[model samples]
Target: MINYEEILNSSVVDIKPSGIRKFFDIAEQMENVISLGVGEPDFKTPWHIRQAGIDALEKSKTRYTSNRGLIELRREISSYYKRKLNLDYSPESEVLVTVGGSEAIDLAIRALINEGDEVIIPEPSFVCYVPIVKMAGGVPVIINTKAENEFRLTAEELKGAITEKTKMLILPFPNNPTGAIMEREDLEKIAEILKGTNIIILSDEIYSELTYGNSHTSIAQIGEMQERTVLISGFSKAYSMTGWRLGYILCPAPLCKQMTKIHQFCIMSSPTVSQYAAIEALKNGDDDIASMRAEYDVRRTYVVNEFRKMGLSVFEPKGAFYVFPCIKSSGMTSDEFCERLLKEKKVATVPGNAFGECGEGFIRVSYCNSLGNLKIALSKIKEFLKENKNG
Candidate 1:
């Protein structure tokens, strides 16, 4: 047999598989599993968005777009950002369409990091940031955000993690798994700390459209910080366009130029049909976002209340479709809690440790499914908790 290990990149080999996927695989093999594990929206792409993709196909618009993406789509993205977030970018120079926000993040990290440079990541946030930073030849520096602060990365935490080697800081809010959001004041403090530094902020705002109570704020919206922030977003969560694989990155022209080079060689451009559909989503999808957000809000409330009633300590999530509840009260590690719950109750939830080490005593439960399904999952979880409660 060929020595595959000898040929593989050492860095890639060292990275472990995603912690979320293991339980998902087990659930997939089981019958009648009520999964609260995956972070995808249960909603289908809104009718108009789907229709636009269909129309594009009917018109035979299947060729590759410009390496930077279709100009019209970029322009729509520019206008949408300006109107919704008060952030401005020149479409012709500062925007690059990507396969998904995943690509945009990869491009940004690869373009910016040199070997041994340190990239600070706040967790439990997203699973991709550390590995992407490592793949880019950068050192992964982690700052474990606390549940006491609702998992928002404090300015103090950022300052503590920074050193001469620090090159990038990933800001993922409204965060995944934890469902934590950094409000304006929280972001302002972070902006202040980063004001004079060379540290680039890779702000992943994929869940921006899902925030409830207060509007989502980007560090890019802060004046001095805008020049250093690469803002990434996609249609996956908000518009239910996950399979369409369309996303974009907005950065200062200089950074955009570098990121586009990586994107050009690696991806060339996002899918043409998806680009057309994304344009429709940006222009005519406000009602769709509102409808979905309202529905999620109901599910969010129900899930939080149910978890609390079970005597589990769950921080109220203000955004995203997830709730991270402390499983410590059940006297089990996150992994044990999830495994036992899956085996006994037939409900699947991702262990919080999938997101980071700080997630050890918690489990992430996504509320992206229907209210009826969530109710069933919650009841199953309640039964599991009762059986496993700490003495």
Candidate 2:
């Protein structure tokens, strides 16, 4: 027999599969299960944006856009950033629209990392970062965020991890799996630590617009740090455009050139209709974002408060839609707690270790479902916990 495993890249075998998917597999088989396991928003893409895409299909503008993406879309993205984030980029050279934030991150990592270089990614973060870093021939060094700090990465922690091999740091905020965000003051401390290092920053702001109270801050917004930062954002979260697969990369002119070459070779461009739809999203999507964010805020508050009343220790989430709650009170490991909750109550959630090590005692609950569904799920969870209590 042919030795297929031997021929496959050994690195692929070494990487751990995402723990988030396992609960989903079990949850999928059962009927009437209430899942707070997924990180996606429960909203549909707004009608106007969807209509623009339909119009494009009718006009038959179905051919591929230029690898650098449409000039009009880039211009619109530039304007959108300026109006909303007060950031500026030259559309002609600095913006390369991506298929999604996933591709944007892949392009950024592949463009910057040489073999054996290190990418420092703060943990209890998105599951994709470490694997993507490894595939690009880089080492993934994880830094654990603490619950007391609301999981924000501290400057001291970031500074301690840098070494000569460190090439980049992915600042993932309004973070996944834990709704952590670093406000301007929080980022300034990190900016100070990175000033002397050669480390480039990948500021993944996919959840920027979803922050609850404070306005989102980009590393690029800080003076001098802009040169070292590539802003990664997309319409997936804020505009309910996950299925649209639209995102972009904004970097300094030199890095933009490097990333553009890889994007040209790999993706060509994001979908043409999606690009048109994104233009509608960027220009007119603010109200849609605000409305959905308001709904999420309502649910976020509800879940965190409900979890606390259940006697679970929950870190206060200022952004994104997840609540990272400690489940150690029941003497069950995060994994054991989640598995039991799903099997017994038909309520699905992801274990904290799914994100990284320090996530051991906790579980992530996304508030991306209907209020009625969340209330029902919480009741089930409460009953399960009370029944399982060791005391």
Candidate 3:
């Protein structure tokens, strides 16, 4: 035998597959599966945004862009933050266009993490933070945010997780899986704790535009925290531009310089057509965002209400399009609950354990599908609950 396992990097090999995709893959193989699994938005890219890409192709703008991305797109990114978030960033030095928010995250981790450095991550959050930290040779110190706290990372939790070796703290607000958001007051508390520390923050705010009643707030917006925070966001969730593969990073010039080095060697630049399209998104896509958010709000309310009526304990989410509902009453582990639900009811939903150990006994349900589909899926789940009450 060739013994490929011996040749492959053990660090990469030993990592477990993403728990979010397990049931999603299973549903893909079967017939008539109603999935609330994947976190993708169901909306199409707006016509004008798509037209911009088409225009780029017609004008033959297919060559590689600057290593930092087209200056025009970068300026738009800067302007968007300035106009929308009241945060100032220089397009030339402090902004980097990335392949996606995921890439920006990876670059930030690789740029800042030294071997044995500890990264404090709040969970029931995204799955990527831990693995990314591990790959960068950093230790992941996890703080499990309680359900009673609406899954927000409190200052007490952040204080307790900090150590001398702590290098970065990832703030995944408008968080995935759980739809928790940290308002301005929440950010202030966290900023207060890090006042004198050397700790940097990796704030992933990809879903910033999707907040329910209240607006989204970045920790960087608080006092001097902007100097220490790397803000990663993009056109994915807000503009429904996931497949376009465009995201950006905003931070201090020093950090951007280091991250750009990694990006230059690993990814020459983000997609040119996508960048052209993104400029248009930043310039004129506010209406699109508003429309999408309104529709998502409707779906969000419906899903949470339905789950509550099922007698399941659900943390009412105020941001993002997901609802994390506790399925402990079903007397099944998260994985078992998801698998049985998929097999018996033909409904596919991700187990909450995929996000972190603390997510066990809950299921993360995306309301990103159509209203009709959601109604059908929720009804099927209700049937599953009645049929298998304690199994």
Query: In candidate 2, what are the lDDT values of residues 1-391, reduced to their tens digit?
Result: 9899889899888888899888888899899999899878899999999999999999998899988788999999999889877888999999999999999999999999999999999999999999999988999999999998889999999988998999999999989989999988999999999997789999999999999888888889987898899999998998989999999999998999999999888777779999999988887888899999999999999999999999998878988889999998989998899998999999999999999999999999989999999999999999999899897
lDDT of 3: 0.94
Query: Cα-based RMSD of the predictions, in order?
Result: 0.8, 0.9, 1.0
How many backbone collisions does model 2 have? Answer: 0
Misplaced by over 4 Å in model 3 are none
Off by over 4 Å in 1: none
Worst 10 residues of 1 by lDDT: 382-391
lDDT of 1 by residue, 1-391 (tens): 9999999999999999998888988898999998788889999999999999999999999999999999999999999999998888999999999999999999999999999999999999889999999988999999999999999999999999999999999999999989999998999999999999899999999999999999898899887999999999999998999999989999999999999998999888889999999999999999999999999999999999988888888899998999999988777889989998998999989999999999999999998899999888888887787777667
Q: Give the TM-score of candidate 2.
A: 0.98
What ranges in model 2 sit over 4 Å off?
none
Instruction: Give TM per candidate.
Output: 0.99, 0.98, 0.99
Clashing pairs in 2: none
lDDT of 3 by residue, 1-391 (tens): 8999999988778788898777877888899888788888999999999999999999999999999999999999999889888999999999999999999999999999999999999999988998889989999999999899999999999999999999999999998989999999999999999988889999999999999998889999999999999999999999999999999999999999999999999998899999999999999999999999999999999999999999999988999889999999999999999999999988889999899999998999999999999999999999989997874
What lDDT score goes with residue 347 in model 3? Answer: 85
